[model samples]
Target: MAELSENSSGYGGMKQVFTISLALFIIFLDGSIVNIALPSIIKEYSTDLGMASWIINAYVITVAVFLVFMGKIGDMLGRAKFYNIGLVMFMLSSFFCALSTNVEMLILFRFFQGISGAIVIPTSMGLVRTAVPPEKVGSAMGVWGAVGGLAIAIGPALGGVITEVSDWRWMFYINLPVITIALFLNKRIFQHLREKTQPLHFDVWGTITLSVTLFVLIYTVTKGPDVGWMSWPIIGGFTFSILGVGVFYWIEHKISYPLVDFELFTNKLYVVGLISNLLGGILLAGMMMILPILLTEAMEFTSLQAAYFITPLSAAMLITAPVTGRLIDRFGFFVPMIIGYIISVIGFYLLTSLELNTPTLSILWRIGVIGVGIAMIAVTSLTVSTVSVQSSQSSVASGIFAMVRNVGGAIGVSLFVSVIMTSFNHFSMVSIQDSIQQIHSTSLSTYEKSKLTDALKAQQVSFFDRNYTSHLESLEISKNNLGEWKKMISDLRDQEQKNKVTAIHYAFIFGMLLSIFFSISAMFLLKKSFRL
Candidate 1:
């Protein structure tokens, strides 16, 4: 512990904080960057969307499942040692990911990359907690949150730029240089850190049951929409997850050296912080997934242009996170947290008003407002969760915080996607039915009416596939009703656009409800007058 305390002052402390943050930036960056490049990867490998999606899903599931296990391992062995080892593994995995010849290979390497990230994340927070003085912990956490927020927010933009300028593989190739610099700094800064010198007993069954439980739960959520939610496979997955969780807690209660110490949950502040963190994760992840789709699919912006439009989100978060941390350090977590939720609720309400003709500045400002609120909530919750526990337990606490947030994010993405698609389908069908009746009332020949009806049906089937023109051209309508055909097509296009806007509006309404719930939870659960 002396080695940890000795570096708690002056330039060395700041260097250590930044070094840990640098590694975290890359880990968090990878989580979103690959999403923007998924289409490119799909084209190159000649794979379907379902298969290409695993390139991202595999990494997320792997990270969420292994985070706590790796954190406990770091506690038993040494934080610095595992952190450095993870950096090396990350670099090597990035190399292999970039060099992969097929989608399967890329997914496999991404799983390895996820494992490396799991090893680094919790341990990095633990290192910061132990290395920084107690008073400055909030500020340190703020910096950590800021860097991570900026990385995740900007990842899509950077990926779009890379994919446009060079190739998707460069997304992975770029990690090498960043990791090299982090490794150099890590070795120089923590050279004197020593490992724990005690006999260790690993919790084999607990690890197994917990891992199985998480893997099944997340896998089920990720695939539920693709495969029907009530399908046999999904039902079985839910059943297995429930049983596995029961077994895991039973094992943990009986074990001498459990993977996760149940005592952490006994702390009221910690539990409240986690709940708030989970809600915040749901909002942030869902918005990140949907906003890009809205820009590209509805607004008809290119990927690069969409990325540029969303830049204010990252910028707002980067600027707000550090300041939020300092506020927590001075005034406490509760005030900043409540204020954050209020701002977020306002932002979500603004999002619900988005229209087809909404100006670019309106969209940018709405996103920026949400970003600021998210940054505040995120930094404050994380800082509280970290500071509420004993120093010895910081690594595991960090792991649990991270795992909950990831699970919430997964749920958010799944939920938002389901709502949006279902709503879109319903609205599209209504529009098509109305158009069909209108076509029936027109005084055209029976044959032309039948042709137009068939075209409407075809358009409904392939609405989201973005093949409207091709589908219409394939119908081979007679030139006699060409004017009516063009008019009908134009009306259908306008209705399609409206359906899209209505679907997104409904999604944001859901988001607003979530934001309100988040606010209510923070107000009731958190102490009104507490300070770090």
Candidate 2:
């Protein structure tokens, strides 16, 4: 308890904030930087197109799995100890990632990187508690929040530049300098004080259960589409997850020092803030991940061009976070949060209506509006949730908050990808069917019909004919003269199928609409606590 108290706040606390926040920025930068380079990675690995996705999903799953455990670890070991270890691990993993020669190698390294990230993220927040006084905790947290937002905004652009100028590896290489600086500061000026004199007894069962449950749950959701959703693997995975959660909840309640204290949910603000973080993460992360891919693949922009178009959205987030933090500090989180959601609704509505030919500048401007709105709601909602908790529980509260955000991001990506796959598959199937029908109806000079009939017969046992082979051969020859016509039909239908992807973009629009609902709910819940 003394260690927790000492870490909570004082003059030494102020200096620690910059060191820890900078460390956190490096970890988060790893997250966002990879998004832009995913396309290039796909090309280099020559793997499944969707394999680019696992780079993100794997990283998210690893981080989400360890957050609660690491949060508990911070309570046991000193924050600075795990903080430095996580940093070293993250830096080492990044170096290996930069040297990776294959997709499998890259993913393995990325997983280790995520474990380090999980360690750094929660402890950074715990360190903040030690650094700032209670009255100004929100404001100090705001600054920490701003660093995260800036990294999110800049990460893609920086990754794009690195990918374009050299290769995708430089994005990881870029972390070394930042890590070096943070290490020096940490070693030279930071002091470590053990928090609890009593030997910390970890709830071993609770930790394993929670970690297993999250991993299985996320893995099931992510792979459900590729593997049959009802297949044994998915079903078994989900079953394990449910069992894990039930057991985890029971163990947590029974243990003297629970991994996550269930009592925290009794506070309305914590509940609301947690749920809001979830929905907000889904909204923001889905957009960031999908829009760039759409720009490059669906719209035919080059990687750099797509990155340029995304710049304004990141800019909007960067510009508004600090301002929103100040406003939340002064007036509370409700009104501004409500306004932000309303603005986001408008921006998403605009996004849904975009066409294939929509100008690049126009898209940027609309996304910027949405970005500003997100910044307003995101930081304040996070701040309000933490502030609502007693000082003693703040570290735990922040851990849960971060975990929600990570889970939400993973779910959001999985959901959006599922949407894209369904849309693309439907469009392809429909286009093919329509073309086949049109070919059947053509006045193919009798020759064309006979030719197609024989071709179909050769392709399928159902259409095979024994006696008509000679007659069909002649017909096939005549039809062969009209080959250009078949080519024309294929090209037309392919274009139409491509057009259907635009409609799929509206799925994202619906996702933002969900964000609106979340915002409204937050307003209803937080209205009574506006003073905070």
Candidate 3:
């Protein structure tokens, strides 16, 4: 056993690393893969979109809420033990999720899946820390990140294909095989990889406050559009989120071992990275949500074709992520991050220029540029955030960073939708008003006015004739037509509204610029840390 550490026997730490990474892959893939299959799920279960929609949000909310507390639990209990428990629960929940005949059962099982994910994700990394030698931790982390990234990159495409060939349920079925393999390998290899258990003291108040805060916050953003934001329920949600957050902070300050160490934000690296995560994720997610909508609505692409546009972006990201990861490990964070943000800004600029006539080839390349930018941001931001913290603190740091990113995504989706709607209304009103004014000015011929009076069945007033019936008739016709035109204009406005919302793809352009701005700012902060 002593010689096991010294002897360069068959990759001593590789199995454990792979096991943890495999678990990550399953969790992340399940997170996103099910998205493509959601419509099918709704149809299969004969459920309303509203209720069936909880499948995804329930999982996301549960994962986000419980992550910090679970991470802390891993620290207290054995990391591997928590991870294994999570794995078993996740697998069981997946089975239940598969067996679900209705929306409510699926949502219930999904909550369990989220709890399992919360446990698995953090503890997986924690287990890696315990299994690997100190010197190899960074490399193991890279592998872990890379696998998870690949899983994410592959999920939607894979889900699409599976759903197309078979049915949407296949997406969930796919996880069973992966989980089975993970369970087998975990039993064989990970049995010896447990961390030394510390005195277990789960902070109940901290957990409740933090979880409630996250739930209220995410729930409000997601549901606000459905239920009007100013409605009483939404107002209460916002109130609860604010109060819960305040209480969480207070609890953290007072508790002996808090789920989150709120003071860590004072660290320059942590703060910059957290902010960058938020902003950058907003940009990425905003593009992701809206671009697909644009493709289907305006561009008239099928779901498969719409997803294909993103293939270039995801492909570019897949290739660039590991390289960026290596660069982060070597040259430090600032340079690569700045380059990534700049690249992203250019990508967004290119996307902003998209028009009805934009060619597919050009769209593909533009998206690829954006993908490269995402790759750079993902690696550099994560490196900057996690590397500064000691291993014991990494899980909490990562959890908080993930939370910020998720919230950013939510915020981006909400704000982007709102911006597009606002722009649509503004542009449509301008167009309609201008069209009406143009109609008002062009004087109708006498012949037209005569016909107009007959249509109105009224004595009409005529242009430049005080007593002429033509003018009054013309006014009435104009008024009637104006109302018809208004309706047409409103319909036109709706169409144009959709188009402008499509055109408002420019939000990402603005977001990309914001990303560049923040990335550059992060550079200066990073420089100080590196120089010291």
The C-alpha RMSD of each candidate to the native structure, in angstroms, is 2.2, 5.9, 7.9
Shift of residue 311 alpha carbon in model 1, Å: 1.1
Question: For model 1, how many clashes?
Answer: 0
Q: Per-residue alpha-carbon lDDT of model 3 for 364-453, expressed as tens digits? A: 898889878876776666666766666677666767776777677677777776666555546555554554454445465555445543
Q: For model 1, how does the per-residue alpha-carbon lDDT over 231-268 read when each residue is reduced to its tens digit?
A: 99999999999999888889999978899889898888
- Evaluated at residue 382, the lDDT of candidate 3 is 63
Displacement of the residue 231 alpha carbon in candidate 3, Å: 6.4
Q: Clash pairs of candidate 2? A: 3-195, 7-130, 8-129, 8-130, 13-131, 451-476
In model 1, the runs with Cα more than 4 Å from the true position are: 1-12, 192-195, 454-463, 469-480, 524-528
Task: Give the runs in model 2 whose Cα sits over 4 Å from its true position.
Answer: 1-18, 36-55, 101-105, 133-136, 187-198, 228-232, 432-442, 446-500
Write down the RMSD of candidate 2 (Cα, Å): 5.9
lDDT of 1 at 511: 81
| Model 2 Cα shift for residue 457 (angstroms) | 14
lDDT of each: 0.84, 0.73, 0.69
The TM-score of predicted model 1 comes to 0.95
Instruction: Please give the lDDT score at residue 530 for candidate 2.
Output: 61
lDDT of 2 by residue, 405-467 (tens): 888877777777666666665655555455556667765656565556545344321101222
